[model samples]
Target: MIADQPQQTRDPQAPKGRPTPKRSEAQSQRRSLANSSSKMSRKDATRRQREARRADMARQREALAGGDERYLPARDKGPVRRFARDYVDSRFFVAEFFLPLAVVILVLSMIQAGAMQTYVLLLWMLVILLIVINSVVLGIKLKRQLRKRFPDENLRGVVAYALMRTLQMRRLRLPKPQVKRGERP
Candidate 1:
């Protein structure tokens, strides 16, 4: 006699196990999911994105001009850097005039008149000497000030940072100078 076989039946309310879906159905599901995430129209989304970018740029510009630390670049962040910037800005340096002096020297060198080249050479040497001397003085002063004010702060690259800042024209420096000339940082 044949043995009576027991048939397995899935419960109607149970989830379907590992069924393969058709391509069209899968595509439809993906479309629905993508649509659900962002309900706004494309134009509206783009407008919002543009506005966000504009707002961010405005904040950064303001930070650069006003010396706001939070929005400043990584290199310019922290009290150590702020102090360095202020220190550089408070005093005049020969390095700041290097660009203008170089332009003047260039024009003078272009003149072929007798002794013009000689004077231009002398001016160049003088300007370079003054800049080197100024940089040395600025470095020494900045190091002393940094040591005094930021005793516990890491001071790596700070002297270089201030020296580089000194090279840039004051009006063009990023995180524009907050302290007036001759003011103590």
Candidate 2:
């Protein structure tokens, strides 16, 4: 069979008649290629790492502002959380004004006069009552909607998540509100 076959021609680009490299030599070359980053200087590596981190942070910030699910933090991920966020955002909540109301109450409390003290106390009580009433109403309604929209979801922390989002000033809420006030989520 060998004698009957014509001679094969090698390409001009072929190695100059050198024998194949040993298995160890081939493996070492592959390892070096795979880890070529080992040759990078420490400063260069750090700079590259810093740039990558900054880019990631920027993407996360954009996602938070624009409600992009893919880059959101784990706590903010998932359709259930998105729905909860939207449900909280779509309505006006008294809890959203808690900070300003608290500040006003704080300033009022500083007035030491008897009538002002009485007024401040009343205002504080009223604000707290309103917040509690509002939160309860919101929770009840949200629970109903959640049940209707997502019956199979694990709803353990979802209500709390929506309530907490309500507590934040609307302007400061992370994964910023996609639904406008009074809009259906």
Candidate 3:
């Protein structure tokens, strides 16, 4: 009789005895929020690792030095500072402004003469002399103006130094090999 009796199955409509594990959106939000901070993000973790490595290296350096600190040598001041001078020598303000104008005038005078005149050499020489003399005077005036503005500053030298530096650049002392020239480790 027992062998012939069929086993009874659990009712399909009955609820499960165990508690369900489903989480609500609010619960998931809370869990993710907590995890976002608790779990070190890749970026933060990498930064922390780098910082630790740097500290370790610094400590190792100090230990190797046996407490003796090494100081780096002072770098050279620029050429501009080394060669600074007073600028704006005021001796030739009129000449500075008039040199160009004088050339223009000389050309016009030559044109007016309409022939190879007797004064050509004189006019040409006059322009050249004016240019040279006025240039010197201009340098002086520039120096004077610089003195007035800066007072304590060496204006003419500064101006000259600045001009020279602007026109030229310091040469590089060494050539760096290109990365592609050797195998990158």
Candidate 2: lDDT of 157? 87
For residues 61-162, write the lDDT of model 1, one tens digit per residue.
999998888888789999999999999999889999889888988988999988988988999999999999999998898899899998999999999999
Indicate the residue-level lDDT of 143 in model 2. Answer: 92
lDDT tens digits, residue span 1-185, model 2 = 58989887665665676667889999999999868866557678899999999999999999999989999988899988999998898888888999999998999899889899999998989988998999899889989988999999888888899889989999999998898999987
Q: Rank candidates by TM-score, best first.
A: 1, 2, 3
Clashes per model (N, Cα, C within 3 A) = 0, 0, 24
Model 1 residue 26 CA deviation in Å? 8.3
Count steric clashes of candidate 3.
24
TM-score of each: 0.74, 0.74, 0.25
Candidate order, lDDT descending:
1, 2, 3
lDDT winner between candidates 2 and 3: 2
Number of the top lDDT candidate: 1
With candidate 1 superimposed using the best TM-score fit, by how many Å does residue 157's alpha carbon deviate from the native? 2.2
Model 2, runs deviating above 4 Å: 1-43
Query: What lDDT would candidate 3 get against the real structure?
Result: 0.44
